[model samples]
Target: MRYLVDLGWLRSGLSFSFGEYFDPENTAFGVMRVCNDDLVAGGKGFGPHPHSDMEIVTVVLRGQVKHEDNLGNAEVTKEGQVQRMSAGSGIIHAEYNASESEELQFLQLWFMPRARGGAPSYETSSYEPSQMVNHLLPVVSHTGSEQVASINQDLTIYLSRLERGNELSFHQEAGRRVFLFVIEGELEVSGHVMETRDTARIQNEPHLQLAAKEDTKYMLIDLP
Candidate 1:
């Protein structure tokens, strides 16, 4: 991952090439293009920016995010809240920290849509931390269910918090992909150890066994 410390306000660990970071060999993973672990100082953030034919999802880990767009959508998303914005044809938006005294930490993910050229849209889904205790809580999906935020891709995103010594497992059909990101603490996946902010990209693996070495918070994405 490429880490960027910018202007004393934004610090990011980017899993793929984005903004001023470029890596030809680490450009994208299947339909998932960008995964940025970002921490923004209070009262600071990205100014107005434009996007097109991309699906942007923000998972707020701490503090809050104040989001606004040209589509007349404005919302404050708190911790454990997942926000999705489809920049179908085109959209301009801004994201700022809602608290002036606390820093904001979030994961910014970008995915390529199956098809392009549609009206822009935005949505948010809230989840209780208790629901994620030792379980994979589906927070974003393509199913359009009321329980999760809908995305324009054939994928699902899960968030989980596992106590030390606990275990979790996931199974998917053959030929699928799994992307795992550790938000905090330590974990062991299929014999490989991962610490905080670590990422794993797995393919051709139908089943995964995860063991928490410490109280761990993580995000996993099942993708086509």
Candidate 2:
């Protein structure tokens, strides 16, 4: 997982095993695994890559990303858009910037699927920040009813674009884990001040409350 600190043509921060950073104990959080925050230089991006038995989700934070896959799904995902690709058996895909003069910033997440070896699939959607203001917008879920592509896990990704002075409260269930990733602005969680790209791994808590210190956009993973 990579999280960039500032806007730029190319930037990244890794949150898990990548390159020389390999901590076996810090590989994943529940079913949620890789979370990379990336900023791509215009006209540059990752080449074709292969993935298997994993759920790949991309959330565009700024600019646009061109996606092409073996499943014949090809499109440019703009800011506020989300794309999910299920590499059940296997799939090859590539991501590139959609503009020649503008940089692209995005978040890429990987989750462990409940079961393996099935046909791959792809889906995409968009969520405006205004719609998520001060509330949890249920984007990805195990069930497809929430408008996000269904994955093989009993979890949901809730996105919040909050305003200063507003708060978000959640009830934590037993045996469930919550992974919070701050995307923009600042938030106070469990006495910790989380800035952009900072994540909090929380579990065994009875309740949760996030107070926004500024207009904040973040993703909260409710995982079992």
lDDT (0 to 1) per candidate: 0.92, 0.84
- Quality of model 1 by C-alpha lDDT: 0.92
Clashing pairs in 1: none
- What would the TM-scores of all predictions be? 0.97, 0.92
Tens digits of lDDT, candidate 1, 19-80? 78887888889999999999999999989999999999999989999999999999999887
Candidate 1 stretches with Cα past 4 Å from truth are none
Shift of residue 140 alpha carbon in model 2, Å = 0.6
Which is the leading candidate under TM-score? Answer: 1
lDDT of 2 at 120: 91
Instruction: Report the C-alpha displacement of residue 97, candidate 1, in angstroms.
Output: 0.7
Among these predicted structures, which one has the highest lDDT? 1
* RMSD to true structure for each model, in Å: 1.0, 2.4
